[model samples]
Target chain A: MTEPMFRTPLRRVRGLGAARSGTGHFWHQRVTSVAGVLLTVALIVIVISLLGRSHAAAVQILGSPLIAILMLLFIINTAYHMWLGMQEIILDYVHEDKWKFLALMSNTFFVSVVGLASAFAILKLSFGV
Target chain B: MADYEARTSSGARRPRPISPHLQIYRPMLTMVMSIVHRITGSALYFGMLLLAWWLIAAASGPNAYANVEWFMGSLIGQLILFGYTWALLHHMLGGIRHLVWDTLHGFDPADREWMTVATLVGSIGLTVALWVVGYLAMGGPR
Candidate 1:
């Protein structure tokens, strides 16, 4: 089959190429992987700092602006990276078309839920709400 | 055909011939590491859920946060936390390994073997060292 072209601007902005060979997914995954590595270190610091501390103290630590922001970034990137990683796994393993589509949808939903849930918690704590 | 994705997209359906699975190929250290990399990545999914719960529990107020904290302090929780710690470190090393490959070097057999061993050793060493520091930080309570 020949490659499909999108004359529409909306589809073009989405990075779908003529051969569907866009680098967006690869780029996102790599960028987030690097970010996840750095953020993971920052996360270990926060956890270690929280160790043996009270609930109030832990909350106070997490609610700090810097920790909250870093944690949010870590959570968001990790979830998205996970979605990309799992998508590749499902594509490689799930051969049947029906199951593949279903699995893909579930992957998207699951990642979004995890990301959103983490973001909400972080934002709430950061705002001291 | 190697273009199985394209063929299937065109609505002609057949039992898509898959490339050789691990069964057909003799498992080497590097090959095993590749599969281990994938498994570690998947392991982080559940680990992420645990993290999310911890964060939410912290935000939810004192008692809720205390309950989650206590569970994490329990025996099974400690074991899971230990595994999570190791998995995170292992996966991070795996990511670094890939990043090195992205530079277009490290494809030689020796380099590949060296990296697989490095990742395994580095992750295990880091996890153990971190736990030791953690224990000491707790004033030798354990």
Candidate 2:
């Protein structure tokens, strides 16, 4: 067969032209979205169970290593999924170029801070530190 | 480069036309509600961080836990909690509606309309029920 006429770097990458790399983000967001749906229900049940209990009782529940680990995972995944969803909303509605950049940056920063703080809290609680 | 010219001349990289956007379609109640579900779902992400903080602080010590309690007992905290509860209910009902749709049911226009309406009403109902339960748990209006 004759050699392919076009050898541009962009053309060499499979599925990289015109279609964009959005499919990965889209699929990831959906996967995490479904995960968040399940996690949220479990979280709500946990919180409701804790309600009306004294602060000390709540502490005992959270101090369990198992609960701490689950909370950490939930926080991280939830923040990441939220960030992805908000990015889509910002990209859709924020028309100004500068504002869009700022929005994206702030979104990333907000989610990161939330995730870090939550993880730190869980670790401190689990370790009694 | 030769490849660049070849691709360009061959019209293999022409700008693709974009389809019309949301402006072309009339707004509907279901569409608005669906968007709201996403907005509230996003809000809960940040809200859960607060919950995690409270739980952690409670686990940490009396001092740390007291601080969280003080904040959550304040007027502002109650207001925030109210909003959080409503958001939770809204997102929960919205999720149930999505699960129904996933099962390939509720496709009819009338069913879709009823589902949307039910979610809104169910959210409000659940919020009210939770508050009532909370009130009773707190000794019922003193």
Best by lDDT: 1
Which parts of model 1 are misplaced by more than 4 Å?
A: A1-21, B1-21
lDDT minimum window of 10 residues, candidate 1 chain A: A2-11
Cα miss at B105, model 1 (Å)? 1.1
- Winning candidate number (TM-score): 1
Q: What does candidate 1 score on TM?
A: 0.85
Give the C-alpha miss distance for residue A121 in model 2, angstroms: 0.9
Q: Model 2, range B1-142, lDDT digits (tens) per residue?
A: 1132223576677544557887898999799898999888777867866776786677567888788878877899878887898897898788778867867999899999999999999888888887777657656666
The candidate that wins on DockQ is 1
Cα lDDT tens digits for candidate 2, A1-129: 865767665555566556567367766776776777677766666666666667777777766787776777778778887888788888878878889999999999888877787788777667775
Model 2 root-mean-square deviation: 8.1
